[model samples]
Structures are given as C-alpha cells and as structure tokens.
Target: MSRPNLRVNAPLLGARRSGPARLLAAAGLAAAAGLALPGPVAQADTASVRCSVPDLVEAIGRANGTPGADTIRLAPKCTYTLVTADPGSPANGLPAITGDLTIDGNGATITRPASAPAFRILFVAETGDLTLNRTTVSGGRATDCPLFPGEGVCGGGIYNLGRLTVNRSRVVHNSAVTTVDNLFAEGGGIDSDGTAATVNDSEISHNTAAYSGSTPSSAEGGGLANDGPLTLNRSRLTDNTVSVADNTDSFAFGAGHAAFALTTIEHSTISGNRVRAVGGTALAALATGSPLPGQATSLSMTDSTVSGNTTSAPNGVAVGGGLGTNFPVTLTRTRVVDNTATAPGGTARGGGIHIGRTGDLTLKDSTVRHNTAHAPGGTARGGGMSSATGGTVRTDRSHIRKNTAEAPDGGTAQGGGVFNAVGSTTLTRSSITDNRAVEGGGIFKESGTVTLNDTTVRGNRGNNCAPPGSVPGCTG
Candidate 1:
C-alpha cells in the first residue's frame, strides 16, 4: 500500500539566500579561516530506495541533512538486513535521525542479522521527529553506551529522545542486555525518555531485557520503557520477558510495559509477560504511575485486558503480577485475571494488582479474578489486589472472585480477595466471593479501615474477614 507524502516547509535559517551566493560566502569564510566547511544543505525529497542496506543508509543520511521533513519509501516486501553498526555516533544500524523524518515502509522489514554486533536498530536524537508506518523491526541488540555511560544501553529496536509515532508496525525479537554490574539495560523493544511517543495499531512481543552481570544489576521493560508522555491505541504487548541476576540487590520491573510518566492506554492488551528476580521486587506486566525523580505520574486505562502475566522471585518479594502502580490510576471496563506472583522464600503480594504507598486506584466496572499468589516460606497477601501504606482503593460495580493466596510452609496467607495494609478501602456495589486464603479469605484490614456500601462479601474459604468482626457486614 502506498502512503501519502506529507510536505513540510523548510525553516528559515537566519535569512534565505541564493545557492550560489551562499556557496560563495561559505567558500570565502573557509579560505579566510583555512577550515573545511560542511556540505550544502539538501532539499526535501520523497525518494524510493531499493532493497539494499547501503541504499537505506544513504537515504537516511540525505533525509537527515535535508531542511524539511523528508519521506523515504522502502522497497515493498524486502528485508534490509544490517550486519554492522553505523560508523557514526550512537552506533546504530542506520544514522541517528536528527531532523524531521518519516519512513514509509511498504510492508518491508529493516532488521539486524543475528550474528551482528550489539547495536540498536535506530536512534532518534532530541531534535528529531520520526514516524514509522507499516514496518517491522526485529533482531536488534543493545549492550552498552560508550558515549553516554550514565544512560546505559537501552531500546534494542528503536530509541527515541524527541517525538515518535509508530503505526501498523511490529517490534519483536529484540534484546537489551547489561554485561556489567550496576549498569542497566532497559526497553527491549523501544525506549522513549522524556519525550512524547504514540503507538497506534501496533504489536510489541517476544522481546527480552536481561542483566548478565555476575553480581547484582537491573533490567526493566522487556517490551517498552517510557519515562515520558506515552499513548497506546489498539495495540498489544505480549510474551515479553525481563530477567535480572538472582543475587542480592538485583531488580526486574515491568516485563511487558513500564511508564514513569503520564500514560494512556485504549483498547490495548498486556498479556503473557513474565519477570524473574531473586533479591528485588519483580513486577510482571505493567508498571505505571510510578514517580520519576521529582515528578509524579498517572495512568488512565480503558477497555484494556491485563492477563496471563507471571512473576517469580525465589528469595525476594514479588509484587503485582499483572499491574503495579504508585501514584494515581483510573480503570474503566478493564480486566485483570489469570496472573500469578510467587516468592518461595520471601513475601508475595498482589497477584492481580498492587498499589504502592502513594497510589490511589479508582476502579469502575472492572473485574479482578483468577489470580494466585504463593509464598511457601514467607507471607502471601492479596491474591487479587493489595495496597500499601497511605494508599486508597475505591471500587465501584467491580467483581473480585476466584483468587487464591497460599502459604503452606508455616507461612501466613491473608486476603485472598483484597489486602489493605494501613490503607483505606471502599467498595460500592462490588462483590467479593469464592476467594481462598488461610486468613481473611475475603478482605484483610491490617490496621486500616474498610467501608462497604451495598457490597457483598461471602462464599470465601478459611474466613470471610480477619478478626471475626473487623469488616462490617462480613461474617467469619
């Protein structure tokens, strides 16, 4: 399919001049200073490139040098395999996009060969504006950043620092690994840091972010990591995995998606994502609403499904197998189900959703069910939903059922349906039933208040509520 070209006007650089006059001025200045001057600026052009890596590289270079936004059309149904990194800065397969550029991929693929050295596929600088349409990015690996060591190596497929839009694209089979200790590897598929990115009708799946250090290290966002304003519409992030060393101080977060800024998700699915950690908390699928530095974040999700996600921390804590948040969140018509959180020698909390100390969750018309949390040698709490200190959870017309919290090896299990630890919980027109736990099978209030208005809590195993009369209108 052909995409229409978008024409952009060139910016006026100080003052417009004729080509010959500008060349003469540049030559006279170079002669006076005895310094080599840059080449002439190229005009914007819509070019079609053949199925060659060199042609693609040259086309991107020309587009980057153009004054206005240039559109490069890739050869249809062709695979442009990159075997080596660009000999320029950032060490990407193609030149780093520095200006407004768009690549109209007519069902074409641009990927790195499996035997290629560790390098990202694309990088968009802070002054760039990149748009990708109908493209596939795969088989990219990012190891480290020599130029910017503090930033570490991130975004195996595409790294965006300015503005980015991806439509009808697939980002899969990419990896970002950290070989050294304390250094990090983030965003196996894409990373947009302190920028704006929108993904429409796209799929990001089968990506990995791992830390291979002998000691402790961190790995985050197997599919995507964004510390900026991000929007996802009609998209899916599935089957992504994040792994960290099974040592102390190691951490892995958000195997499917992680956002530390304001984010919006509409008609999206985050499913089948996994996380493995040993000494730090592992959040499996979605980790949004977490504050970044001094800025607080929030998430607004509608018509979304977060299911079939799993997290395991052998000697550490596992929190939120499906969704985890720390600021504020609003969910409408969403479902969190079939997620598992396991911590064999540690604590396991929130098999479905975990709200941190500063989090406030407003769930409307949503469902949390079929989730499990197991801690064989430690405490297991909240098979469905758990909130930390100073958190507030409000549910309206929601259903929480069929969840399990088990600690069979002399450990304690509490709140198979909902766990509130020094937090406030209000349920209006909601039903909590068929949950299994050793104590507080329906709802657990650990020094917190529980308010129920027209809510039903019954059919739970072990006990309906802890302390016999802790929760009003709930039977033990």
Candidate 2:
C-alpha cells in the first residue's frame, strides 16, 4: 500500500530562516516584491493570502516554517492559477506541506493551468496534516515525472502521506497517465497513503486515469485511490474513467472509488463512471481490496446510491458494473441500479453487484434493480447479483428486480436475479421478481445452495428457477 514517489531534494525555507528572524525575512521578501500580504485574521498564527499564486505559495512556505499548526484564509472566489511547481517539491504546484495546516478557501479555487508543466496541486508529507474547506482543485496533470522515472505518476490533484480532510470542496478535471511498462497511473483526483482521509460534502468528477504500457500495468481509481482508511459522507463521485491500453495483463479498476484498506461510504453517490481495459476490468463505480485472501479489505455503505456505471472488457471478462468487491461488504439502505456490464467476446457477470470468491456480502433494506448484463460471444450471468466460489450473499428486506441478462451469440445466460456458483445465497423477507434471462430467470444454482425464507421469486421470464429443483420454495 505504498504511495507514489512525491519526494524531492529541494530545501525548505525554514532551513534558512527560523524563529522571529524567519517571520521578519518573509515580511521583507513580500514587501520587496510589492506583495500585499494581509494581516493576521483572529490569531497571530493565521495568514490571509491574496488571490495571487505567488502569495499562496509564499504563505504555504511560511506556514511550513512555523512550528505548530497554522491557518490560512484565502481570497473569496478568486482562482489562483499556478504555472510552475514549487521549488520545495518538484511534483507539486504548491509547496509540500510539512506540518499541520488548515486552508479556508472562502469559495476560491486553486488550480494549475492546462498549458503548464506536469505537476499536482498539493502534496502532504508523512509528518504533515492538511485540511481544506470550501475549495476547488482542478486541471492538474501528473505525468512523465522526471524526478522518479519508471515509478509512474499518481495523484493528479493531491497526494497525501498523512492525515487529510476535505469539506465543501470539489476535485475535478485531473488526470494521471503513465507510459512505462509494469507501472501505474493511479488516483486521477486524489491519492492517500496515510493514516486516514475523509471527504464530506464534496464532489469529485471528470477525472481520468490511463495506462499505456505493453507489459503488465494498471490504471486504478480515476477519482481516488486510498491505501489507508477512507470515509466519505454526503459526497458525490461521478463521471470518472480508468482506461488501459495494454492487451497483455494490464488492469483498469475502480473508475469512481478504489481503496486497499478499510472504506466506509455513507449518504454518498457513485455514478456515471466507466472502466475500459483489454486485459481486465473490475468495479466501474466502486471497488475494494486485492485478490489475495490475506490482504482482503472491507467496505461498508449506508444510505448510498450506485447507478449508471458501466464496464466493458472486450478481450476479457467484465465483472461488477456497479459494485465489484473482493472482500467483506455490507450495504444498508443502499440502491444499486441502472448499471450495464458488457463483454462482447468474453464473459459478463454482475451487472449490478459482483461478489468475488473471497467476498461475503450482507444486504439489508437495499435494492438492486434495472441492471443489464450482455455478452454476445460469451457467457452472461447475474443481471442483478452474482457470487463466485466460496462466497456467500445474504439479503434481508431487500428487492432484486427488473434486471436482464442476455447472451445471443450461442452463449449461456443464467440467473437474471441471483446467480450462485459453488457459493451460498440466502434470502430473508426479500423479493426477486421481474427479471429476464434465457434460463433461470429468478434464481440460478450452479452447484451451490440457494435458500429462500419468506422470500418471493415470481414474475420472471424464461423460468423461475433453473433445473426445476435447485432452489427450493422458488417455482415458475
């Protein structure tokens, strides 16, 4: 769970100026440069920065020079466009945060010009803690990093190695692209390898992560990639993309949200995201964990919505159009709908949700509906929900309906509602209806156990249950 290399050998301003002399020297530099530095707001530790990019950079450098935590108030509604990286960090537009700092944007913006050099907007070191409020960070490109060759670029908008919290903010129009083999282009919007990162009342959209390598590479988390604990509340992550142009063994994963550690999402929305990879694709909207059982993570969602997500893997299997999980998951009062998964020449599974072989899911008071899974030249299964071997899915007071699975090119289509392959599926007080498939319109049992308790499986097309006696209490 290591983050991208954001380190540089540039010296800090505090190295030359410390204590009262540093403050005096900073004020002298500002005065000599004809800079209008605002007086302290409420406290001596607070510095009100003007709307200029140079002012912002100098303020950050001053804050880094201070010993304790500092507060920086920015100009209202002004967009500070940076055209060069800070001398302290070669990969960041602003100086690297070396200590605790809070920036009150006051509805302003911090961005890098599209024609500027390749660098991210912000970088927080391991000992730094950053908090942003009412800010907008956009138009950052982390690509072709000469500082760290072969490591690939990451965190186009912001990179964090300590505690980071963002509130009432937006991160958009950022990109992370890599040109090396066996490298990664990760976190188009934000990347965190810290103790924790939280986002509340914010939006992350229009970000892209693309990997173009002939060897085994990966493009992950078009919106965010967190290697530590992550929590999202009342936020939206939409219209992000992860694309891989390698037919070898490359992967494109988590177009909206990707995390390798504990992830919790509440009252949030993840929609309109896409993933396209020739080697493989997973979790077009939300995904977590790795393939290894020892490193499996956990995800919990409450009162959230995952919709209008898509996945396309023409050369390989497409799994989990809306939610692709490889660890433990629990969804309460969540809705996963209107997702599409298509693999024209390969297998397609889990239009709404896919539970991997090592994943066990619990759904309570949730709905998985109006999803489609299509594979014209391969197999299609689980238009609503699917589970692999050794996985278990339990639903209580939930609804799975209006889902379709289609395989029209002499391929198999099974489980329009729920598919259990060598796994266990148990439904309690749930309904699986209005689903369509060539076979097993309600429930498909492929060498697994399907138990229905106080659940209704009706109004399905083709058939209610495959093999007639596979799922007890469910009949056409």
| TM-scores, all models, native as reference | 0.88, 0.88
Checking candidate 2 for backbone clashes, the offending pairs are none
* Candidate 2 Cα misplacement greater than 4 A, ranges: 1-44, 143-150, 291-296
lDDT of each: 0.81, 0.81
RMSD of 2: 9.7
Tens-digit per-residue lDDT, 1-476, candidate 1: 11111011111000001112222343465477576566567667799999999999999998887787799999998999999999995468889998889899999998988888878898887668899999999998886542234545788998876689999999999988877755667889987763579999999999998887876556778999876678999999999999888764566778998766678999999999999888666775887533434454678999999999998888788888898877688999999999998999888889999887777899999999999889998989999998845588999999999998889889989999998888899999999999999898998888788999999999998888886888888886
Best by lDDT: 1
- Global CA lDDT of candidate 1, please? 0.81
